[model samples]
Target: MTYKGNQTTWDKLSPSLQQKIDTDLSGIRQTVTNNKTEVTEHLAKIATTENLGHIKPDGKTIKVDPATGIASAVASTSYYVEARQTAGTTTYDVNIPDVTAYKPGLTILLKLLENNKQGAASLNINGMGVKSFIFQTYAAAVQNAGELQGGRVYQLVYDGLYFTVIGVQWVSSYEGGTDLANNPYILPSYGAVGKVDAKVAALQTQVDSKSTKDVYTINIPLISGWQGLAQITREDNNMLTLYLDIYGGTRTGGTKIGTIPAGYRPVQTYSMYFGVVTTASGSVSPQGAVISIYGSGDIYITSSNIQHNIFIASSFK
Candidate 1:
């Protein structure tokens, strides 16, 4: 029944409209015979507006508008996308389907494919323009090259401005030596979390099964006449160490020293040649010495001249 004026009597109103008042407004969904409680019962479920969320949207958060005092369900993007390798290193582009709107507090997880070169780095998430990373955990930290590494995940949060990098995972460049001391954003590994003293330290564990990591130091075996020791350790990310100080044997050039064993060899390749130069007074010259480590666990010391008590530890390409 259509109302012609603002004033209407109980008997004049149609039964259908009164029932609509019960179902849509009062939430009774039945014809009301009694008109005594009409005013009081009509106010039931007054807040049930079409703007309010009824259906549960998965990965969405219900928030209240401070200005209008109305609640709404918005896309939160509370999950992460699979690791994406950015085509560009300095400017990364990752496509996450769930990221539709660029609002404040919207966070995104990025898995990088290559090391971010030094200078500055930015992210273009879902083609949402380039946003430079204003990385900050404690103080204002400038973006450094190689800080955001490949095969690792990082979180970026929008603050109505630049996305701030508030977290950092372990710098897991096993054979590639990237230490954690420079990375002040170190946190616990694996899925479990402990009490973190700093906010940055609490965010490192995520998106990888590689939770266990360490440096291995194995002593290389020597022949009967060889007396000194040779130790190979994991030093830097993508780099291995081979330090040896052996003497007392009549060393032959281009000859086998001994096997370094299977587990002790570098994991990068089966066989690798390291043109190492060692300084040995009088016997072996640093210029002519060549070290060859085979994947078959054989280490050969090839030097035209012999040496004793040689200590060699320097940079290698």
Candidate 2:
């Protein structure tokens, strides 16, 4: 039996063979129909004058400019790229599909990973022509040790001629000891540097207290960063023993030096002299006398005798 165009010798074929041919042709017809639809869709897409992304041979989507006929691989809107380290220095290589196709005002996001070293990292944008980018740590120029640490994310914008970093997320963990006090590039938000300033400010306080008959007491406010330095001076009074207590203690001897109290033995004591003065008894009194003490926690001052004016100067760190 001879086969003709679009017609097989069906009458001469066996029933089983004819059934097989029918099933095969049915599958071919369905395949052709599906292919036709796909071709039509592709042709329609090509004919449209709009900027549509097309799949490239490499399975990447390439954006096509309808008016300019320029094509470029579409960059990710928000992407994360890690930095590589060589010889203790971190670096990155940003490869753009087409530099010319990257329009101004376009932004890209990158998350950079760094090593525990004290050196500057670099980002090289290949094929960027004369364009350049400056990366910063905490809004300051990234130079010297500890500026570029692990876990940093930055947002870069292309401004037609160059790329500029517009945003940053700096991790608090610093390598190379680049703290707020040491590294000028590290801002208060980066590490514990902000607390250092508060600690320094809380180091000193001045207060005035008076003792009337036997003992005098003054309340020293509690400070978080208090270190403990107390300078106490007697403004007026006769020659008598002065007892100091940070917590609270009883005085025993008339000329006994102050004690740190039963529960406050950790407080350190220091003796300071003010000057000599004449007592009401017509005798040359002890020179201007002052006592300096250092410790932590609350301060409580006690002295002997009434009408004794006392000035207390304290510090912390």
Candidate 3:
């Protein structure tokens, strides 16, 4: 049967075309009316589109265009932070000098001071003072102690403390290292740093042991219960790996502070379910016929060159 737009008995259009037209128009209208509803429906598989998917796009948000009156472009980058180091040589003292000794652009150099020296070796700069900082080595003369050859240099400039270690390297470096060897530990730097409260706090259930790398599970009420999730085994040194299994599915992303000497945030990945229900006359592609579904986006969240943190959170229902 056919139904025309005469608002009565214009039986000229096929039912399938009518349905598809109805769906596409309805989507455009709904986007005009309410965004939250549209976003939820799109995410929940209630609504469908050709190339649309559930993706928190990089820098571009699923926002409405004020002038065009449709959901169009949105800001991309959100927050930033630098990943910290896990271990460093405790050869120098890390303490904050008096404010009088502080000067902008003046490089502050100091050591993280590792009391328990072992492994690749690194000092912890957690509770050190800010300002009064200097650099030295246990055995060799190291210039740019803030950055060294044996390891990395974690310098808390404002606090005047620093650590000489290389626990965290760039992800690209990790890939290169993997080409030579199959070790994920030689993977790269991870996580983020900076003053607290920079990004949105996604407080998860207080973990009992923060060092466990087994197949753990996280129960999120949003997803209805505890789902089997994989433990973050191959995380960057910054501790910025969030691995989760929700609704019998798995999603990997996270932002955490650790002992690495750099910072980074997880980039957003996209996945969408789309299809056409029926075909139109003279058209091969039908309505509700799924065309393509996948996820893709850039890796880095920003182009600051200066390192930053990787903050991430996810919910599935």
Candidate 4:
């Protein structure tokens, strides 16, 4: 018989039933208090623990200082092994306690301190089960036990099968952008502008040299780009044919510059003839012209001299 809110109903209940209800209430109160005390004890242990060994998501255990609530992973052990070939120590074997202890993404940095040895030194990584480890000074395609140089820092990471080289320090060169202060690499400056200026200067010099013209003798080859006048005098001629071979001018055989007949020879004494030669025209073939006289004429053709004057232009077409 449970107790009701009404005092009349409670009074109607048997004393034995009422005593049972009171006993049940006392047990519930004690259980609640015990649960609160257990919770407080667990919280206190969490707050007081100096080193909280918590497993990280990567399966590595991190130690947390409960007083500061700062969590930190265990640092990798650095081995500064001295390898000198002069001392007959060509290879240094690194002994890792357990190969299975290494997980993927685990990194270890090792420094190889050389002792000014005469020959090269190498490192042999041991204790990693069937897995092979490759060490190199720079990134390479092949895997091998690389030669160890003095004062070089190498970073190695395990990929569950092989310990691959991911980074290196004290290298001679780097491929990508790096800090200019300590790195040996240099950035290239703009050089195309300087090259263009040099080319333009050379072209200007050529143009300047092409602007002068000079006179030449027609008997010799004519110049490439000039036109000149020549005077030919024939004092005595018996169907004389004079070849006017300009340097770069042309004319047909029938093209006559002057003609003298036998009847007018002694009477005239001398006959003057003038002709023009130019290297600028495209109609001229074979780059020359001929002056001839034919008429059964005994005439003296003379003009200052047999060789005529020709001028050559400075500029080329």
Candidate 5:
């Protein structure tokens, strides 16, 4: 709500003796009005929040930050060992088997090639970027009764982006199921590997959504009263002409009344400042004509860069 600056706070009171005190206070309201208007207008011009990332396109990409989370390189190839028994469990020192054979408990190297290049480096597994797991060495072996366990189960986590498994080619093999002399496993036995997506990938999608909402609220205050007389204007003293153009007849081009450039700058359109205003019950002239504001581009963001002019009712007529 607004008020005419002709009456002062004290003058509004009912007087019994021709005003308890004599004073010229009519202009007092003008000062108060101007003060209040300036404050509100100033508050509107403030930048609440902004998506600092939007200013730069590269900011959208996620880079490994060593200062925060753990940053490590993805493995080109990782291997694990698994042991089994055909007869009784024997305590034997085993090593990684060659890539030519297939034997239970034999360490097989899983090569996670990026962009088909074994030396290619990436941040996550699949196309979605999320660093939850990395390729590492694992060992599995079968144990004797009460000695340890039955058979060792090794787990290999190949977590990286852009690298999909084609097939596991056997490198080599070793001693067969048991201690038999004739039992011998060969090499080059290949197997199929399935691809799996990481959970961190899904979590990143959620984070982006929340970030967008936060950015929206931050720029709201910067665009307050966007369509009113507080809008940016040019020319030293053309208030009357500008006012007439905006609400004047269906005039077009530079001849229109409110023909000021939409942005705070003298020229050029900052996608953020280019928009049309929809008014419902607010008038530029005589009385009530509702005005609803809408933006075409990133108006809120652009509005923050412009200077706004707020005039109290007394400043005019």
Candidate 6:
């Protein structure tokens, strides 16, 4: 390139100085030409990996630091190889058109033609022998059936010995207390999974058999000249109460007014703390008798006494 400044001062110089300037200009031009030749030669040898274009005199892709040009090292992402399972179940027979031999980190897009039916599975790619497959990094964990579901696309990397899957949508062998053997796909993220039971929508499963607003049907024995009403109500608190007034004549101890259903019965004779009684004359005194409900669901006076109205509510297991 020519010098970027004007040569106006050259004409005003003494003849001898002008001669010197010309001589120096000639030498600079020669130097620049020689430098260009050396640079051109140096660049030609920098690199010429065609796939990454050669280091011509202009900007170009350079692959001098990896694979072919350099010593063993991680290569660029492998060529896209489409693999599809052709047959076999536990050990799938795969066809990866571009794969002839296994290479470390050789990743491929695999399409499963059949779902695996065993906890362990392997893939034999193009007769290259079987390579263990996994949906996760745990090589020791049971692969479990349906782990590699069919009709699904998965990315996998060949780690020399095994093909580690990039993963498909699965719950995994561990984690999630949910029972999904019947259905593995997740429900749409909307309402509670699988329409919730209306009775339990606002509560958890009452495994202890506790209930809300549980009314017990008691068998009342009809007594002459006795206007008695018995109503037992349980609020799931393991306690029963009388919500209606009970009027009865003097009955001896062990007289069964009624029996509660099996679920409402106690394990043993349970004395109720709220079975307070009053005489039909509406007199509240020591003349009243206490009631005890037995495991047989028998409800009766704990001891002999005149028929007293049980002004009731009870706390018992």
RMSD of 2: 18.5
TM-score of 4: 0.27
Top candidate on TM-score is 6
Clashing pairs in 2: 203-315, 203-316, 212-306, 227-316, 274-288, 275-287, 275-288, 276-287, 276-288
Model 6 lDDT per residue over 60-140, tens place: 435555435433335435444434444444566666676678878777676665555665666777888978775554654
> Per-residue lDDT tens digits of candidate 1, residues 1-317?
23344445755778987676545644333335455366455444233444343223453334334332423235355546444335545677767777776777777776666555666667677787977777565324335464677677777787776778766433322332445578778643422222233434544443243445555677877874676877777643534577777777556665676776655565532323233435455343436555666666576656544444445553222
What would you estimate as the lDDT of candidate 3? 0.32
lDDT value, residue 8 of candidate 4 = 84
Which sections of candidate 1 miss by over 4 Å? 1-31, 35-44, 49-75, 82-89, 138-144, 168-317
Which rank order by TM-score, best down to worst?
Answer: 6, 1, 2, 4, 5, 3
lDDT of each: 0.57, 0.46, 0.32, 0.43, 0.29, 0.60
Number of the candidate with higher TM-score, 2 or 6: 6
lDDT, model 2, position 95: 69
Model 2 weakest lDDT span, ten residues long: 245-254
Task: Give per-residue CA lDDT, model 2, range 1-317, as digits (tens).
Answer: 22354445557778887788778888889999999998876665453446566766654556656544443225335444555444544445666554335566566665655544544444555644433454534433343245444577767676665556664344553435445577777555444555656666665321123334333333333222222333232222421223332322222112222333332232354443433534446566554444444343223322222123333443222
Q: Write the per-residue lDDT of candidate 5 for residues 89-206, one digit (tens) a residue.
A: 1322234433223212222323321112112122221222321211232122211232122243333333222222222122223323454345466322222111113356667777
Q: How well is each residue in 95-176 modelled by candidate 4, as lDDT tens digits?
A: 6544336566556565555533433333455534433444444333222223345576656676666556555322333233
Predicted model with the maximum lDDT:
6
**Which runs of model 6 end up more than 4 angstroms from their true locations?**
1-33, 44-47, 50-66, 69-89, 141-144, 168-317
| TM-score (all chains, Cα) for each model | 0.34, 0.28, 0.14, 0.27, 0.15, 0.37
Window of ten residues with lowest summed lDDT in model 4: 308-317
lDDT of 5: 0.29
